[model samples]
Target chain A: MKRISCDSSSIIALSSNCLMWVLDKFETEFIIPFYVKKEIIDTPLKGKKYSFEAMKHGLLIGNTLKVKETDPILRDKIIKLSNTLLSHKGKPIEIIQYGEADAIALAIKEDVSTLLVDEKNTRLLIEDLEGLKKVIERRTGRDFEINKTSAQELNKLLKGLKIIRSTELIAVAIKRGFFDWPYPRADIVKNALTALKFSGCAISSKEINETVDILTQTH
Target chain B: MKFALDALNFFKKTDTKLLRNLSDKILIDGFIEKNNELINLSIVVHSLSKICEKDYYKKDGVYWKTFVDKIQANLEEVASDKAQVIILEKIIVELDNHFGRYKNNVLHRSKIRKGSTLYAWGVSLTLASQMVKIPEIELMKQIGRTKIVDEEAQIKTISERLKDAEEIL
Candidate 1:
């Protein structure tokens, strides 16, 4: 089974869409950090009933979706790194939360296959293609090609960790027959991606359209 | 202790006059004493950002919004000072990104998955302060997470608490 660690946003996104039940069907082991679990399960807030219920359902799923505690030393290091991680403008802004820091730490320590997160800042900090472009532009005052050298540098910075969003998960779920409906296959996939977007998946419309195109073609 | 107390009090009332006075005192002290003003400026900007955001949603008034903009303008002017430009620009950019995150109801939708605006703001400030070398405990205390007298209590690690939370499964 593919081992995956998730942040709170992805979990809530999956749960809010009523597609969390398909998590087990995908043959992936979902691991959540303790802080992420508390964000969803322990603390109950108004206007967040869907996330609360999703967390309850996640708990009911048992070992397949385990909640793991991060190693203290690793967590501290990740927190420090995340705090020091500069933005596109090279400012040391602490954008990642404890839960995100813990999730990344657990992934690094345990060697998880992927980390599921939906926050834009964390995503940009990790991959940062646009940010890399901006950096280049700021330094040279001109556009530069994103060649292998720049890509390698970014990969090294991100530590070669595979990051996926809830939108991609939804795409995979649709591919695996989790979103079968009476409507046309294209419509079903489009609607599924749109639903994820509306539920705060942080996917762009262009990405959604591309994912829909690929899924439809594969089908 | 006084600075921490004043900061804590500022969060409660979110008075602009209080913030202005505090920033002025810190700036002057930093200039005369040759101490770093980056941390203090970051804290002030962070607090102002939160207050402006809260008022944006709560009162829907133009007063707080314009006041925050004016403060940013003033900060930009201060940034023109040769020595302070870089750090102050970083702080201003961070503040801009912080507000930009909620642009166009994106954060409004995400609030369902994340916690309320209050919770998000609290966490952001806590982490941002940590980046600036402010103690997390102090920020938490200022945010009313811990009582003033209980400041010496050891905060439990998340992993240690998770050991007990495992029983929830």
Candidate 2:
């Protein structure tokens, strides 16, 4: 079976008003890293208990799926990738480390045709991994690779779903370094959210705006 | 951040109006059913207080103590059940003490820029879900928020209202 594995980065994008469209575009076995589950519990789904109901239906298939632990070899590969990215970027590769990398390694281990990843720089990092490089080169006859799409493509896909408002998509896009820079990107997302009317759901524009403002003003 | 506080204040003022615009039956029955509104309000206040107490900038620019007191006062004034208000106050205090122990030692303004909005939304919605019994912790284990993806199913269930609008208008 041609499997499809996802990093948490993709999962975050998919669950938040983007699921409907992404699923429409890509359908296959989705695997998440065990660390992804830990990270989810640490944040995002922090207080909401409904995640259980969502998980029951296989929103994320990790704990139930039999995944080989990070063998010493894979661990060394990840550590090297981390160090190389850290050396190059001067800051750590934030999202695509730890469990996320494990997910990519697993996908390659499974010989999956497609790996759904969302972070921008993951491709570059994966280029340095020997095992994955061999697979990518053999598969593409050029290089073994981590497949990816940009935040922009994800936003465009969301727009197509009409699940979230275009303005909101643009805002998220801008926030994720989508809009170029300087201007408050969340403003774009807010406008998009307002435009979508968000299914007439009783959304707290006030709270969202406030949080974004706080984020902008302080940071 | 400035905007978030202003927005919160705006929401507080308009909160009653929101409950007001609904039909009298809803206000009297639905909003009051099993003290759902009261529970929701208490949870919101509790979470706000928690945020205020925990935020790093909270001590520098924000008045955590004053803000929390105001929310407490508002709950008392608006609460239909006086006893619940007192009980909720104690719980909030207890929570404050408990959470305070794990306070972040180094919260730099610089790192704030790197925060994830999806993570923020997830945390907020998770708290809201937990209060309503939908629970984000369990949801976190799942790949997505399946049960409440519609959102309308849990928090803002209004299919009946939509049907009413279609029929009457």
Candidate 3:
């Protein structure tokens, strides 16, 4: 079966928006590694505010989304590569961590070409390193020493991995009629995408409008 | 660590200005030493300085003195060892015990804020989330609401990513 490795950000966003049902309906398998399970399910289960949401996520793994194990060695290598890719004032800026690396490793292990994630860091690193450099420099207003060697190595490992955020995921789903929101007459796609943006999907106003424009054009 | 002693002296003087400076120093030390406790402490200390600087935190009666006394006692007595996650949770909890005005769980909110600060300083979302022990979703929203993680800086167009999402699953 075809598979897409998923990280915690996408899962949490989907769960918050009551969109986990789409995982079960899609023909492609969504794999969540053990470390991601610990993040989105186990850890949150022990917390106060999002425990119930974590339970809802746990149920998804049990019933629909498959839980898989990742290569710990690969995960550690990716984390080191990502963190060491840039330096600030002679210190290596610690970038990506365990949860994101776990999904990357799982996708590499499974030979999957795509990763489902919402956060920008790992995605920007994979999609465009130069772009990420510009973004970081613009944000911090400080010069970061980019280790070209480390960037090349990390890019070699992460080559061809595509990122799909929850906003895009839901937009496609709504366009495909996946999100069955009850209020039928409401602009379901637009409304759902807006909710996703506010609820932690890392989408911009322009991106939201662009997506809504394309997705709603057929309607 | 000298930070412990610095924290102690600041507690004695109750100097909100110096405390804010100390917080900045501790945050820089956090990046250098990879110390989670120091980062959390820096956040809470920042919060404490903000609180102390404001007149709103002042109480009219002896209750204010008691509140200050209580905070001073708690902070002064925090041993250098075993200062892992306790600094963040403990300080926030102590404040909650005294100030019933906060609308939300200050500890949780601080963690998200800390994660945002770290991300804006060039830490990855996942790394910042892991350091502050917050869900990436929460931290992402916190940072997303800010202009620090500028979307326009990204190279790919939204439609390209949208096409990938539409085609993949």
Candidate 4:
């Protein structure tokens, strides 16, 4: 069976109406990390559709992926190193050693697992994982590989649902109260639609127009 | 990991001198580097756009109505008008917390000068009044008159004073 690991970012991006449609088309098994599961069900999810409901019915596979916490010592090391590096500027050392760190550590232990993470952090994270594999291969004569799916690709899956249009996803998100305004709604809409289109969902222009109307009225 | 508390310290009273000691290159570059997340960058850009929106909403005379509706929907409170008002107030506070720094921009500067409470009041009262079928002129007159000398009052005027705060669509 083909195994894929998913995180909170993937689920959040996939929740778009259009993107969710495309994701429904996939039959592959997707894994969820323990921390990511916690984030999805937490209080902040109070009224969201993806709230504990997304998992209660087994839409997302929450059991297959492993959980890994940061080693206290290693975490301390990153902090200490960052503190010194940042001391001159008198800036606070805000080294994030948990979220991605846990994901990376768990991925290493899973052995050749494909991770689904946001694109901005992917390059740096993959490089770190590759470096670890290199060190281990040199010492133990063994190697492992990893792959990924970006937020954009996961979004395109929404179009497959065919219930909404890619362009209307942002309006839906806002109307659904997924995001508050005082931010660029257009940009948000663009980002949401980009994700759906990239996810491989096909949508018609007419559908986009209808969605815009619904969103305008409701939002 | 950098906690909010750590960032808070950088703004201490004594840091007045320290701020000058630090170069713009060091501080600005460090901030961008640390917040390289797409969401973080998006937040900055989004906040900038809202000011312009607030302006649009103000002009159409539907600013308060839309703002209250959004808050009510978010909190899932359909029956309680008071609850809706309270939630709208909180939402305004939250928006300020996130984008308060940009209050001086051409778009939000007017809102800030008018104050957050006034802005909230304008939006809430105007929106509430409209839903209840109150005439626009009456709603404006009623909301326009207030002696609640507090930050909330200031916030109310912030949205009202906008050049075009009522262009929802």
Give the candidate number with the greatest lDDT: 3
- Please give me the DockQ of candidate 4 compared with the native complex: 0.03
The pairs that clash in candidate 3 are none
Candidate 3 CAPRI category: acceptable
Stretches off by above 4 angstroms in model 2 are A18-27, A41-72, A85-96, A127-219, B1-112, B116-169
Q: Is candidate 1 or candidate 3 better by DockQ?
A: 3
Per-model DockQ = 0.06, 0.02, 0.48, 0.03
Please state the error at residue B2 of candidate 2 in Å: 28
TM-score leader: 3
* lDDT on C-alpha atoms for all candidate structures: 0.51, 0.35, 0.74, 0.33
lDDT of 1: 0.51
Question: Residues B19-67, candidate 1, lDDT per residue (tens digit)?
Answer: 6456445533332232445435534534553454454343535543554
In every candidate, how many clashes are there? 0, 30, 0, 51
RMSD from true fold, candidate 3: 3.6
The global Cα lDDT (0 to 1) of model 4 is: 0.33
Using TM-score, rank the candidates from best to worst.
Answer: 3, 1, 4, 2
Better of 2 and 4 by TM-score: 4
lDDT per residue, candidate 4, B60-123, as tens digits? 4455445444543533441222232234334544445444433334323322322222212221
